[model samples]
Target chain A: MGEWSNARATSEAAGIGAAGQVQVDDDLALVARVQAGEMAAFDVLTRKYRERIFSIIYNITSNREDAADLTQDAFVRAFTSLSRFKGQSSFFTWLYRIAVNTALSHLKKSRMRRFFSFETINEEMAPGEIVDTLSQKSAGDHSAQLAELQEKLNEALQKLSPKHRTVVVLFEIEGLGHQEIAEIMHTSEGTVRSRLHYAKQQLQADLQSYLS
Target chain B: MKKRRESRHEVSGGVTLEQLLRVKRAERPGPEFWADFDRGLQQKLFKTVVDRRRSGVRNFFRIVLHSRSTYAMPILAAIMVAFGIALNRGSGDGPLPQAVTAPVDMVVSVEANTRASSPGAERFVVDLLNSGGESGNFRKVMSLGSINTPDAGSTRYVADQLGSVTGRGGVLSMGDSF
Candidate 1:
């Protein structure tokens, strides 16, 4: 969060329109610097990729505290394994792999607990503690159209299997290419396409109530 | 392209099927989103560095204390090689250089005990040594010479190899001068 504050301040100064546009070359440069053992370079990379990784974890785990902890663990593992990172894949792809692995390990550990079902967690209530404020803001009024859609979407996402949820998150939310998602998931592109197809069907069925 | 275009259709509800399909491929998150992500990611990175540093320090001392041979062998070999090279550079007495001298004696002595050792190995050694002796590949470049008579089969094979120095290529002959 240290350099994130600075990044945020810089982006804010740059204005919102320019903020979304992170140049791929710049990202690669920063990664090179990170590989060269520059902490500032790593900090920039963390700032750039943190939210996407966090969002993916949050989508699956849906608990703020767990998300935060898992996210930190993910970054830690990524840093330690950075030397082994072959540049065959992009930096984000590598980061995504680390995040997914960390989250899965967390889920595996929690699976022993009675109430530890990942699919049962509410998406809106994810990033667990941090959302309390947001939840309170929407406490009384569940009447808004966008809010209702968001709720429906979140609920439907929770109903997915971990594998399908991952496919959906990467393909739909994260918007990675099918090939890229295939690489991240360590599967064939055909499998990614099939899973994505099935996931979309399931999501559509789950949110059927909202469609009308 | 055609298939994708055909596939792009609005669903029965307000949000199209295309919208759902477009999610991950949809436009990237805004700057505010990234800014938020950065904060959380940095804390995670810092925590990891600290953890690794702690683990690294522990490992460094553990290695120093145990003095494991697995760790020691390569280091020892490297140092020896370096020292050998350095010694050769100054006084010209390196083991590798000495092994490859062309003028060195070609006869490599072998223990005559035949029943004790494996068969054909002597012949193979003889062939190798004889080839080296005559061609001087092993003797001149490798600085190794001499095949011993105790291993008669190998020695004879070496002798045969030494005889073939012209076409078959043997340079080191038995009793050759170093």
Candidate 2:
């Protein structure tokens, strides 16, 4: 098990590195075109990252309408401030920072009006993936049980503080590293790790019934 | 070994946090939503860019209005001072015009009253004030400095007329002029 896990980790790290390199090259080319006064190049960058950016915002806001609006706002801000974007970071990183900051500000302003409404999951996944993962250590009818677990998961997520929720969403859902999350959150990696640990502990306590 | 143990501990729950989060990754809006999103975003971006350009012009004016003392006041004062110097250079014939020497508050009040009164009366008073030499009352006031000269008799005559028009109090004030 240890050997297999180590091998998987190695392969995943290599895959991420290669993917990141390709993304960096593509983003640089697109950003250069934008800097040279080609407005259409920005559309390409927006198209590429819009879904991911939207997903990040959606997880934070939990309201599709607010997410949609904020996603547009983030892209608009990025395009307007594109000239000030020195290539010190990858284009996505800069874009991600903007999107995160926009969402955080929105959350701050609309704190009183926060209400959670979970959306249905429709993406293609291996049949019973969530159920199988859960059932490996417990027991349930994989189909109906998975639905309940999903609802519980979203409830637990919404219960988290915005700061904790943001770190968890970015790290776990978006598969970002602690360092990357630290950069996005504008804090030390140690803070990011601490928040993630506390967030997971809270989730564990909230979903204790489902997990057991 | 510690790192491995930590990794294992992270996934100690029946389902890993990553797997639970994956459930959410699947919860995206449909294709139709994206179709609408792209079109809506395009329109919004175009409007935003255009609005930003418009606001840039507006912001320039706003800054000028707010910071008038800094950039605009000095320029305006300089122009006024230069115009005054030019007017002074040209006016060697006599003392400065009564319009220049008159108290500003009195002129402003007269101008306001003239505007508020009948148009015909406004036109006459404004013309009389502008053409100061011809008006009897104005000529008397202008010649006060030259009372000892040949205009002393004319000054006394005009003062009596002004006293009648302005009443008893006016006659007392005009006594100094005589």
Candidate 3:
């Protein structure tokens, strides 16, 4: 959901520096509630995670339609399989596993690349400093230039192999630490870092026109 | 590779790959997207997940490699024990005890990796949570563990997890509705 977080949520900007324990504990408690036949608890989780689930998938597939569908499927999957979710990993991590696999499966099955449907770039989030420079560089058409840059970025991302793109999305875009991505991807931290490096190198080359 | 070069690019002001990628950060769905998302999820849960209970438990963890890697990973989905197991593993991150007491299986543990075995084989993998992984490169990583649904949709169903069909339910994506 949008802007949907409990009051106990840590500052999203601070990145859960010291309060991670409190958050994870809260997740476990919610997991306990949902396992106890509290459908509403599951709903709480869906609201908490749906946007995230959507974003990861959206970035991976580069197709808004597939991302939206896969996100719902991932949540529904998480809900139905609620009984199996032993709290070994954080619930969000568990949910993420479902989401990534869902996207991979979709990518594997359809193997059909459709027209890319990207989400709108939130104007507020765009770095004004960079936007201003880019605007001047691109003939002062600020919004249009940003939109083009957005498309080019998505295109560059979509060009990566699925695995590389997943790493890039998680590490670069998602801002997850290497160890966390390793655990989520079921790969080693080395692999995460390696994939991230290669993915970035490719992106850097592809978008050199903009970055340079 | 030089450590500094690997980390950042000093192009005058130096726009790191991470910063350039922030453009992707700017791309996010608005509230209307969430409203449709809830509706879609409720509908799919009603359809496919209910139908998957009989497809047989996933006997093996499909640990996809990056076109390069050694060995495999196994997750607990099939052969994942049956019964109403309690998640009373005390509060903390423990490996999920691989037991599926249907209707009420509580997986509470401090271990990060959940274990699952392949029947009639010695191979096992910690691949239970791969169907979808990673917090949506959250526009914001609001680690709100205690979450509540404000007008969350309703459609309850029971069945096995969506292992293969995680991508089957094709809901019409939100178009220009962001």
Clash pairs (backbone) in predicted model 2 = none
CA-lDDT, candidates in order: 0.54, 0.67, 0.61
Displacement of residue B36 (Cα, Å) in model 1 is 9.3
- Per-residue lDDT, model 1, residue B174, is 21
Docking class of 3: incorrect
Residue A96's C-alpha lDDT in candidate 2? 84
Q: Can you write out model 2's per-residue Cα lDDT over A1-212, one digit (the tens) per residue?
A: 13223322322322445546776788899887766655557767987888889988999988888898899999989977887889987687788889999999999999888876656676354224554554564454444445555677888998999899998888777667677677778899899989999999999787665442
Name the top lDDT candidate: 2
Off by over 4 Å in 3: A1-17, A135-139, B1-14, B48-178
TM-score of chain A of 3: 0.89
| RMSD, every candidate, angstroms | 21.9, 25.0, 18.3
For DockQ, candidate 2 versus 3, the one ahead is 3
CAPRI-wise, candidate 1 is incorrect
Model 2: per-residue Cα lDDT over B1-178, one tens digit each: 5743433333235555556666777777888888778756765655665566578668965666678477576665676797786567446445446434653444445446566663587574664466444324343333343444432343343445456547755332222322
- Better model by DockQ, 1 or 3? 3
List the DockQ of the predictions in order: 0.07, 0.13, 0.17
Tens digits of lDDT, candidate 1, B32-59 = 6444544455445444545555676688
Query: What are the chain A TM-scores of the candidates, in order?
Result: 0.71, 0.84, 0.89
Among all windows of 10 consecutive residues in model 3 chain A, the one with the lowest summed lDDT is A1-10
